[model samples]
Structure formats: structure tokens, C-alpha cells
Target: MLSTALAAPAAAAAPRYQRYVALGDSYAAVGTLTKVRSAPIGCARATDNYPSGVAARLAPATFVDISCGGAETPDLTTPQEVPLGVNPAQFSALTPDTDLVTVSIGGNDVGFGEIVRKCAELSFGDPFGAPCRAHYTAGGTDVLAARIAELAPKITAVVDGITARSPNATVVVVGYLRILPPRWGCWPLVPFAIGDVAYFDGVQRSLNATIGGRAEAAGARFVNPGLTTGHDVCQLPGKKWVEGLVPTSLSMPVHPNARGQAHVAGLVAAALSQ
Candidate 1:
């Protein structure tokens, strides 16, 4: 009777998720959207970000999001300048008692930003036959693949480092959301060379796989957003969760919109419940 009276509650049967720490790059920053955390310059963080949303839903816990725009794996491993703010890097915010950690990185490492810039640059003159799209569609660029492979070990190291710090924490690695669909629908605004959209998706997918594999190897759960495939940005408004090449509002083109962030928050929340 004494043991039964002292037994842990059902909610405490499994490790109760309490402290939440988020780490990653621009895509996860939730900047440029309303309620996002702002810095004096560079990429700003957002309170409406998925982590923020999840934190609100899972109240009564500490929430710390260290995500920034243009963040890289080395940013977590070493001390680097905070592009806009005073803080050094996102990892600096993490501690030994973190109950949860979410990460989505490596896109900037592959020069995805450059790709978008080039695409936008070329689209101005030749929307369809742009040299940037041409080079990418040629199927010879191993840059993205090579970059992701190199990052795999670094990401795994971060996971090990985190676990070393918080022996009882649950590390969650979030994958990239789909940018383009298997098929391109809109022209001009989202025009790309034949099959280029799929190619881009494949690269993003490969990069995400590397992140997931490494996270799993380090004993973390991998949360992939690819499950929202058909609902990628290219879809008609009200149907798409992620935004396409062009944003509906005056915001960053490639990053997630508020709706998208909400979806991500739900996913993260579900993972924590498990």
C-alpha cells in the first residue's frame, strides 16, 4: 500500500518533457513573420516559429530557441559571432538539463541561398532557360550531396555533445520542409527547367536523410516534414502548408509561413507526447 501510494503518476511514467531547446538555421528561425524574435540586423528569430508554437502548446516548461539565419554545424561546435545579435551562437544557450532539443541545419552549407539568388537573378532575363536552372537540371552538380555527407558526422557529434550535457534529454532532429513539389504548377513566379523542381526536392531530401540518419545514430528521434508532401508550397493557397518561391505576404520567400510553422509545431508536440 505504501509503494502504490508513492508510485509515479501516469504522466510521469515516461520521461516528462520539460526543458525545450531549439537549434538550427533560418528555415527554423520564424523570422520575417509577425511575433518572431527580432535582432538589430541580419536574420531575426521569431516567436511564431514552430518551437515557439510548440512551447505555447506545451506550457509550464522552459523554452529556449537558439535558431538563427545562416547558422551552420560549426556554429554549434565553435563560438561564432551572432550574425545580428550579441549572443555568440545557438549552442551556447543549451545546458546540461535540457529535456528536449530540436535541430534543422545544413541547407545554408549547400549554398541553397546562393541557388535561390541565382535563380532569382536568372529569372529576371530568361525565366525558363536561365543558366542557373540549366546548370542545376544538368544533373552533374554533386555539391549538395557532398556537403550533406560532410555534415553528417558533425551533426552526429552535436547530438553526442548534447547527450553528454543532458544525459536524460530527448534530442529531436527536424528535417527540411518541401520547397518545390514533384511537379511544378505555376509558371513565371515558380518557373523552373523541366524536372528541376524534382531535382531540388531530391537534394533537400538527401540532406534531410543525412540529418535523420546521424540523429538516429546518436539515439535521437528524427521528425520528417515530408509527410506533408502533396501540400508543398506550389499548391494553391489554403491547400499548401509551406510557401513556394514567392511568399503571399511581404516576407522571406523560402522560409516557412505562419501556417507552416503551426503545422511543424503540431508535429513536434505529437513527438513529445510520445
Candidate 2:
């Protein structure tokens, strides 16, 4: 009788994650990081993106990836109209049967691209001064910081909506990789004015903190890529996870490369296992 009871317990296995849906923006889609051989143009959904890596390791029964470049918080519910194609609402992929969902968004909504572009443009003239910082912080206001604060609620709403759609799914909100070094940045490689480098880094950190807090508040697990230590873009070739202003690989400047995506996948996998 004792043997029978023990065997029964052993025979009953833990449930596996059968369905997974990946949703988010350029970072999540791995835009310009690698080629999207099969995805529609402008979607930039790379085959080797973090989502794909996670799906491979988990080996889920169903995997749906709806991430696209330039997606904003609204794009999660509204169809995103791309230049050459239109992507369906990202949340449409989520169902009650979904066992897992992962998202990496909000950078576009907060104007990260514009900030980078403006910084790069200004850096050409003032390579040693904090020109980018001065531009955004003009009139005694940090516009980018204010934008991140405003987007916090939107992030929470997106998580809540995901939960409403897939009550039983384990949702993971992934944060961005570090792009700058701690003390100084690679001026020649990134071209951000010497003083503006730290300013940009601070902005990225604040954004990640906001994202992490919102994910926690909405009952979703947050996976920080933890790339701040030695994986910044300024690191040596093999050690760097993010690409510089002029990328060495196919990845876009200031975004994660293939190595960064793989590392983020590993972090997500670890979170799931726990």
C-alpha cells in the first residue's frame, strides 16, 4: 500500500507550459539585430530574437510572436500600421489557454529614438559638453524623465490586460540592456558628448526602474538583463551585449545584438524555472 501511494505521487507530473505568446516593440522584435527572413517587411521580427530563443528552450506546444518595430503601448490593443504592412493587435494572440507571455516595450512610447537621434546630431558639434542633456533639460525640466514617469501607468495597464486575457499564464516583463559604461563611454564608438553619456545612462536606468516597478505592481515577473556590469556597448567586442552608434554587427546602434538577445533569453528561462 505504501509503495502504491509513492508510485502514484511519482506518476503525476507537473504541468508543462503549452502555449506562449511574445509581445512588445523593436527591442523585443530584435529589429535590425538580425534578418527576419520569413516575417513581413517592416515587422523586423528576427528569427533569432529573444522570444525565439526562449521558445526553443522551453519547447512549448504553441508559440506566437507578435512583436514589431516601433510598437507603442497603444499598439498592444490597436493594430499597428507599418509602412509596408499592418500587424494585428498584439494582445489578440493571448488566450485563456496561453501558459506564458513575455513583453519588452515602452522605449518608443517614451521617445528613446528621438533622444538618441538628437544626441547624436548635437554631439557632432559639442563632443565634450553635455549638449544633449542641456537640450532636454532646457527650461529647468527633464523632458525624458517626465515622459517615463507618465508612461508608468500605461505599462501597468498593459500588464493588467495581459492578466485579464490569460489569467493562468506566467507573464514576464523584460528590461533593456545597458548601453553605456559606468564612468566614461567610448566617445569614438558611440559619439555621445562626453558629459551627455552619463545623462543618457541615467535616463535608461530610470526607464528600467519604472518598468520593473510597474511589472511588480501588476503581478508580473520582471527579468532585468543585468547587463550593466561589463556588458555595456563600450566593453570589448565579445563582452559587449549592446552595439555602439556604428554597429559592428547587423544590430541597430544602442540596441542589443545577437549575444544580448541570447543572454536575455537565458534570464527569462531562469525566471520561468523558478
Candidate 3:
């Protein structure tokens, strides 16, 4: 009986999810989707985001979510000032004892916001003429490609920092969700030229490839979501994981919605299990 009692205590001592930290930009930050309430202030974090979803599924002992909107690679090391409050450097949330870490970043670093904005603005002139693509490649140089190349080193640095800060943590880098439809885009909903849709999709693919490659090289697991099959923003309202340019719900255009968050959380959980 004494031996049985001692063994029970030993089993109970096994650590579960001791600590988890999520970091990144709007994609990582969960926000309102179809009027669903989440974090009320800075970062617009939603309670139903992948971090939160993972926590619920894994029941981590401790979880901290510092993801913010408009975050760049530098924001991982520097403070970010948002309307609700100032978000500390994302890496600040990490410690050697951190058990798990997940980040979905780098899009903003590649000037995605500017690209989208420019695309939207140029769409008005010629909805079917690929004006956005022409504008970006006006000088026969792909500016966006240059931006991605510039950010590659930064992403590597981030992965190195996370490894340095939490040497034992299971670091998972999440990739961006698909934003364009397969084959054909919903012109009225996304407003991008037919050619521009393919162009943008190619850019996203490039970003994902870079992120996946960097994460693998840094000894971290990468979750690609593999959502491109049929879960693009142009999918039917309920089928889409990412919202279109003109959101059908309260979700921000080009961002993931609740379903998307849940889907990513599942992917993260699966990765952890492996």
C-alpha cells in the first residue's frame, strides 16, 4: 500500500503543459468575427483565437498571448504602440522555462498591408486589367519580392531568438492562410484583377515557403495549414477560412475568422502530438 501511494504521487508529478506563449500580428491575434466578442482593446485579440483554442484543448498550465495587430518582425524585439495600449516585445513573454511557443508573423514585414492597400486602390482604375500587378512591377523589378528577401534574415533572427530564450520549448511557426480562390477569384468580393489574384497567390506561396524553410532550419516545427485546397477567402461564406476583401462578417478583410482560428489550433495541436 505504501509503494502504491508513493507511485501515485510520482505519476502526479509529471508536468503537463507548463507554459505557452503566442506571438505575432493580426493573423495571430483573434478578434471579432461576425460580432463575436474577444479581447476588447489593444491587438484586438479574440478569446477564440488559435492560442486560446490550443489552451482549451491542451489545458496548458499557463498561457500568455501578446499578439498584436500591425506587428512587424522588429516588433518581436521592440515595443508596439496600439490604440488600446503598448504591446511589449513578443519575445519578452518567453523564458527558458516556456514549454511551447507559436508565432504567425512576417506578412506585415513583407509589406502585405501596403500591397493590399495598393491593390485595392488600383482596382478601381481597371478591375480586369491587372493594374495592381503593373504598378508593383512598374520598373521591371518586383518590389514585393525584394521586400520578402529583406525580411528573410529577420525571420531567421526571430527563430534564433526564440531558441535562445526558450531552448526547451516546442516552437511552432504557423503559416498564412490562403487568401485567394483556386483557379478563379471572386472579382466582386475581392476586387483584384484576374491576373492580380494569381500574382498575389504566388506572393503568399513565396512567403510561406520562406517561413517553412526558416523554421525547419532553426529546428522548429512549421504548420502550413495546407488550407489552399478549398478554404480560400473566395470560398462560399461559411466555407472560407480567410475573409475576403469585403468581409461577410465583422472579421477584417484578408484575415482569418473564427473557423480559421479553430482550424489552425487543430493543426498546432496535431503538431504537438507528433
Candidate 4:
């Protein structure tokens, strides 16, 4: 009886993760400020991305990261072409033995890069008003909101696909960090007009909520970095996790910097511990 009880606690406490596979897009793979790693050159997969941090911290027996720049949900099932190389269908890394999976995607599906660029361009036209918001909300439609609603099911499909492929894995969906604050502040640095700042912020919040909802509904866990605000683009280099239109950090404009990746990894690690 003593042996059985002691072994039960030890077995229950044993590490469940061994083979770790990471899937997602730029946010998941590209720590724009960090040096490129073993992934394809075009992937721009950074050595310091959240997955790298997590792997280093957890010291998994095996690790595979197939994340890439500008990836979408379809990219998870189908190969994606990057600037100078092609990232294989992300799901190819999974197996029945895989025990850890992280997903950080869906921004590209909504044309997030283009939206930020457009909002910046529109801000130049009317930096005092909400020209960007007006442009997107034209014809009595909130275009960004519609895109998110349309994308909810597709995001859920990704969860289903991941679970089907890696049945034993503990899936963690890391939500995007904040970009702009809930109110307007930065002007020339980011170029978003006074009203457009909050407008885009709302769009991002909705997207994060969808990602979390899908992950939880599909029996996966979600970690929301957005909950800790003040790391948005408007903040200075040290304070901001995300860069602005003209990046102050080595990261790409509007993407997460090295600090941001570290923060995300910490959040994911905490979630895993729990």
C-alpha cells in the first residue's frame, strides 16, 4: 500500500511533455529583433521566439518549430510560401507521441498587416480625426468586425485539426499582445489618427477573444498577454513589447520585439505550470 501510494504521486507529477511541436505565424515564430535560427531563411524564424524560450525553459526531449512569417490557418494544413523559401504544412511535425503544442496564428487571415498599413496611410490624410476608422466602417459596415466573425469558425477548425493530429499534446493558444492602447496617444511614430487608435485596438481585442474562445471550446488552454496592458506600440522602446509604424527596436514594424517574445514565453510557461 505504501509503495502504491508513493508511486501514484510520482507518476501523477511526472512531466507530461516530451516531444514539443510549435505551430503558428509571425507572432508565434518571428521575434523580428532576434537572430534567425535553423528554420528556412525565408521563415525569418528567430532564435529567441517564444517557442525557443519555452523549449529552453522546459528542456523538452524533442522540439520542432514550423512557424513562419505571414502564416494563416490554411498554412497549418497547406504549405506556405515565404519570401525566399516554403514552410511545409505545419501539421507535418505532429505525431501520436507529441505531447506539447502551441498555436499563435490568425492575424494574417484578417489581413492584419495590410490593415495596419492602411490605417497608417489613412492617418496621414486626417491625423486629427478617425479617417482610418471611417474608411473601414464605410457603407454601414464594420469591416474588421465582419472579418473576425467570419474567421471564428476557421480558427476553431485549426484547433480541431491540431487535436486530431496530436491527440496526446497539451495545446496552448497564445493570444496576441496589445498594439495600440484603448485610447489614442502616439501620432507620428505610429501614424494612427486620434480616433483610429482605439478603433484598431477594439478590433484586436475581438480577435484575441475569438482565439481564446475557440481554444477553450476545443479543450485547449489559452494565454492572453493582452490582459497586461501598457506594452502597446505607443510606449517607448523599453516599455513597449510591440513596435510602431517606424520601429525603434530591431523588430519589424508593428510586430513584437525581443522583449515582447520573452514576455509571451513567460506567460505561456506560467500557463503550462498551472
| TM-score top scorer | 4
User: What do the candidate models score in CA lDDT, each in turn?
Assistant: 0.73, 0.86, 0.83, 0.88
Identify the superior model by TM-score, candidate 2 or candidate 4.
Answer: 4
Q: 74-153, model 3: which lDDT tens digit per residue?
A: 89999888875788888999998998999999999898888888887887788877888798888899988888888788
Q: Which candidate is the best by lDDT?
A: 4
- Tens digit of per-residue lDDT, candidate 2, span 174-229: 98888787646777567788999889988888999999999998999999874457
Using all chains and alpha carbons, the TM-scores for the candidates as numbered come to 0.83, 0.91, 0.91, 0.93
Superposition error at 96 for model 3 (Å): 1.4
Better of 1 and 4 by TM-score: 4
- Clashing pairs for model 4 are none
For candidate 3, the 10 contiguous residues with the lowest summed lDDT are 31-40
Q: Identify the runs in model 1 with alpha carbons over 4 angstroms from their true place.
A: 1-15, 39-41, 79-84, 120-141
The pairs that clash in candidate 3 are 30-46
TM-score of predicted structure 1: 0.83
Per-prediction backbone clash count: 4, 0, 1, 0
Which candidate model has the greater lDDT, 2 or 3? 2
Q: Model 2: which residue pairs collide?
A: none
Indicate the worst ten consecutive residues by lDDT in candidate 4: 7-16
